[model samples]
Target chain A: MKAFDYARATDLSDAIGASGCLIAGGTNLLDLMKLEVETPSALVDITRIGLNEIVPEGDGLRIGALVTNAACAADPAVRRGWPLLSRAILAGASPQLRNKATTAGNLCQRTRCSYFMDNRSACNKRQPGSGCAAIGGINRNHAILGTSDACIATYPGDMAVALAALGAQVEIEGPGGTRHIPVADFHRLPGEDPSRDNVLEVGEVITAVLLPAPVEARQIYRKVRDRASYAFALVSVAAVLRMQDGAIAQAKLAFGGVAHKPWIDPRVDSLLVGETPSKALFDKAADLLLEGAEGQGGNDFKIPLARRTLAAVLAEATAE
Target chain B: MAQSPAARIAVNGVTYEFDGDVRRSLLDFLRRDLGLTGTKKGCDHGQCGACTVMVNGRRINSCLSLAVMHDGDEVTTIEGLGAADNLSALQKAFVSHDGFQCGYCTPGQICSAAAMMEEIREGWPSFASEDVAGRVHLDDEEIRERMSGNLCRCGAYANILTAIKEVMESGAKP
Candidate 1:
């Protein structure tokens, strides 16, 4: 790791205005630094900035940026109101990692693309203008939905997928002022500039995540991976469903490990509404969600795997 | 050249203040500076839990944390758990169960299990839990899922599981 200046910011303004990379639960950033993948001249510790609470806001909840994943998942309000969020977090990294990884840190974590982590391989996400090695190389874990000519790395996270399905908003504080960005629009696709992951601007810091009022729907988060635990999702599905008169009243779906961001499409929800839950209906919804999903050689299986996983989650969610 | 930062941390009930490089990990500081060799480093990355330690009562990967970030924090390492002459209940179970062969990941496994039992007592749910909001039941599946962070290359997982279950069944505090 490179030598750097470290400062602990005592206030939000001090943290946002500091000219350095923000550090909270240095689980991801420090690992990248050890590999020299992310060499920052300075690190501003934001753990003490007093954004570590999970409080009730109106009918919804506002989760502080510094709340660790384990704490967030174990909170009584979160478990009772947003059970899927808790389940998604628990489905992610092991107990030790979830204890240290924070809410803002999880959203800002980098992709697990081997080529991107390895400095020797050509990766546009790590270094702009460099060719993408995963496009032709071993892409078994690469994305199939949000692929670009520049990159095909998947956004490896589970909590964000649940947030996207729940229509959560990200609160940002910067020099300009505070602004709220919908979770769906927070992450950007790997287009021309794959180096940038989210819509966070320079000197801007994520303050908290604003979850809307809890909905009267059954929520489920199912992940499929090579291992039973301590592994990233090969393809995961987050589903929120409401039934009325033996028919679907509302449906929201978000997919992970299949795109550059949490993949969500309103058309699939529209198709499921007013219809009874059935494999045929879910297959059609899967068709709409997987539209134009072209996979690289090694990851072609994800296309069908995502379809089956989505179907299974929807079926389990609607089961009597 | 710029001067290193000064940080004060309490480890094993003893407070130490020093000036160190900002880039040095807490794991490195413990092993190299404090000479706490009980906490071993398996894979410098967070993927391997051989460097696990408790910070402020929560277990975390010491290798992924900077020592400077731990200012004013209380850390409990393997040495803090118990000495060789007076081994902790969890440590004694490991010895009787033959939970390890190489013993490289023992400290991390013990620290993690110690904190994990606390999590279970607090009704924290795991992936294996059928009900997220309900009381936690420490089944074999739950133990394996919770301890997945620590990797034992000796394939002593069966013994480790037995040791942890024994402690839990004995109603002894780890």
Candidate 2:
């Protein structure tokens, strides 16, 4: 941790126009700073700006970006309406970290790739154009889908996967004005420019995450990790299904730890919409979801692991 | 934003004013500046709960937060839990149950356990809770899931579980 100036934001404008990285929970950012992976000249503390509200907005819930993961998970509305989101948040971090980690910070969390975190390694995500060490080094936990030759870092978040499955929208405020970005498009695939994780411009602050009306369906979030707790996901699944007359009426599937973004493909749901909920149908849907997934040598197992995890989630969700 | 002046913080019941680097973590501040080395630094990251402490009635990893971020906030570390001659009930329980072998991660484990019990009393739901809306029953599985952050290298999990069970059964308030 290097010497840096710190300023506590008093209002939205103070946080919006800050010249350095915004600090809410300071869980991930501070760790990166300690590793010298993230060296911000200034730290703008936004925890006191009063963005921790979780209120009803229009037909759904609008979660303030500064809401701590613990509070968001324990909110009655979230627990009843969006159990998948709550479960996902709890599954991601331990109780202590969840108390300090914020919703915006979780969504903005960097990759957990060992190469990217280690400054000694040549990681394009850490230093643009340097080189991608994960492409040739130990990449058992790297991304398998939506990866490019430049980088293969995986997005390490559980809440974001559920958010992407629920069709959540992110609210951002910048120098220009406020705007809304769908959660699916918020993160970008690893392309030539793997340095940029999301589409946020300079001096842009995420205000709130808008979750659409809760669907009347069975929701489940299953995360498989190396250990029972406090470890990043190997491959997680968030499945929501609406069953009618022993048939799948609607479905939504999102995967984590397999891609640069929350891998959500509507094609699988479309294929299962009018079909009977069975192991055969789920296997077919899983196969369709992993159609073009290419894997590094060490991470080749993730393709089949993700497919089986998706199938299990679908089975549990559509179970009577 | 130039270098700010010395920040003031309240740990336990004492107020301390120190001129330290803003980038220094709360764990470093307590250990280096205040000489409160009871709180260990196992990983220096949020992954390990060796730096756990109570801030505004909630438990958080001090290593995950900068020292200046806690200015004017009420903090309670392991040193604040009890005096050497007068150990807290939870501490006494840990000793009786032999909850630790190396004792390196004891302070944080106790502090986290104290706060975790309060969270359960307030109807906070955990990922493994059977009934989200029902009372949080104190069981081995629940305690293990809640205390998963605090890793004991000596592997004293069975005794740690016994200590927490004693405290919970005694109906002690944090």
Candidate 3:
């Protein structure tokens, strides 16, 4: 859309220190730029930075930032070890999009809120101090769990939800140094400034995502959307469970399309940790997770929808 | 501002070097500069797959990718798939099945299906695949799910499905 300088970076240090917006895959950023929603003076292409490897680290796997969504999902080790990640990725976007979209790009993608994308609408996420139009207008797809007076935009990604359930960590490289941020704490709630999606500071770049050792659990990623395919989730659930002696030994749950970030609550997992599989127990866990979830006018159905989806996923996962 | 570097990309085995505007999309470059207008521009966003093209052997929305980002990459557009005299197998199937009405989305559909067949051969699973780790079976559901990116506004999906099924059943390399 706007004329800007572009250059490819082959070295990690060059990419990290470049004074330009990082562009990988360019699925989301370029779309926003076309709409004049995102205007950068220059772009530093990181596709050639050699961050595209998916290798084994310790007992787990380290996925490079430049790995495409399709490559990551189709990897043999990923499909066998972390099926939830594979399933979650395949659930989102179309085949063509997954082919070009990168791992870190998906994590850093902006919300699909119409107001945020439409420069005409009053969106605090787009322009701070402006009013949020989705708060009271066409909010059926807005966030219900992490709503603020300023914004209610959903994170709009399925892979992050699975990663949150897997307890993955995001590796960051910046001018200061290299550090890791847990996926759960990476995305921020739209407290007052919704402009910043994640916790990355200025000039910081996501290098890779470190997945902890795969757990011995039955994993499933179930997404409910307006259509069967090529649509964003209305409400999605990622569940990881381990059964021992007919009792739940471990339970991890993360919800998508319901919050500003992948919604995860430890209380729900604690409730189902040692409990035997039952509809009643699953309902309680769902209730605890949906507690205090206030929905906007059009999205009130998501509350019950999320509850039923969560219960169904838990039931299906625990079913013999 | 500093001048951007030149981008060299190969389309249909022909390499071309250009020093164009950094904001130029791959779709625009193919249509306007190269005069390869077989690729259509529907939404100009990633939502519509009208601009679908293969970059480095993978289908991607050309409208969403900057041409400058494709330096040293090989691209295959509808024009490169096959000429009118020598149509690709998928293209021939489309003609026999009447898989299009306006034919605006046909190029994207064929290009996408061509690459999709490769994905199936590689056992890359789709959302419709029951077993993500198991061998892929090309059922009607898998074809529909994989082709959901290309939108045929003329409601010709039934014919499109039939055309793709014919190619798949014939075991022809699309």
Which is the leading candidate under DockQ? 3
Taking the candidates in order, what DockQ does each have? 0.60, 0.63, 0.65
Residue A289 C-alpha lDDT in model 1: 87
lDDT of 1: 0.92
Which segments of candidate 2 are over 4 A away from where they belong? B1-6, B131-135
Fnat of every candidate, listed in order: 0.69, 0.62, 0.73
- Which digits, one per residue and each the tens of the lDDT, describe model 2 over residues A202-315? 889999999999999888899998998788998999988899999999898889999998988888889999899778888899888989999899999999899889888887
Q: Write the per-residue lDDT of candidate 3 for residues A144-196, one digit (tens) a residue.
A: 89789999999999999999999999999999999999898899999899998
Q: What docking grade does candidate 2 earn?
A: medium
Q: Per model, how many backbone clashes are there?
A: 0, 0, 0
TM-score of chain A of each: 0.99, 0.98, 0.99
Q: What is candidate 3's TM-score against the reference?
A: 0.98
Using all chains and alpha carbons, the TM-scores for the candidates as numbered come to 0.98, 0.98, 0.98
Better structure of 2 and 3 per DockQ: 3
Q: Runs in model 1 with CA error above 4 Å?
A: B1-5
Of the true contacts between chains A and B, what fraction does model 3 have? 0.73
lDDT of 2 by residue, B23-110 (tens): 7889999999899999889999887799999998799999998888886788999999976898999899999999999999899999
lDDT of 1 by residue, A1-320 (tens): 88888887878887876788888998999999999999999888888788899999999999999999999999999999899899999999989999999999999999999999999999999999989999889999989997899999999999999999988999999999999999989999999999999999998999999988989899999999999998999999999899899899989999999999999999998999999988898899889889889989999999999999999998987887
Q: Any runs in candidate 3 off by more than 4 Å, and if so which?
A: B1-3
Distance from true location, Cα of B46 in model 3, Å:
1.0
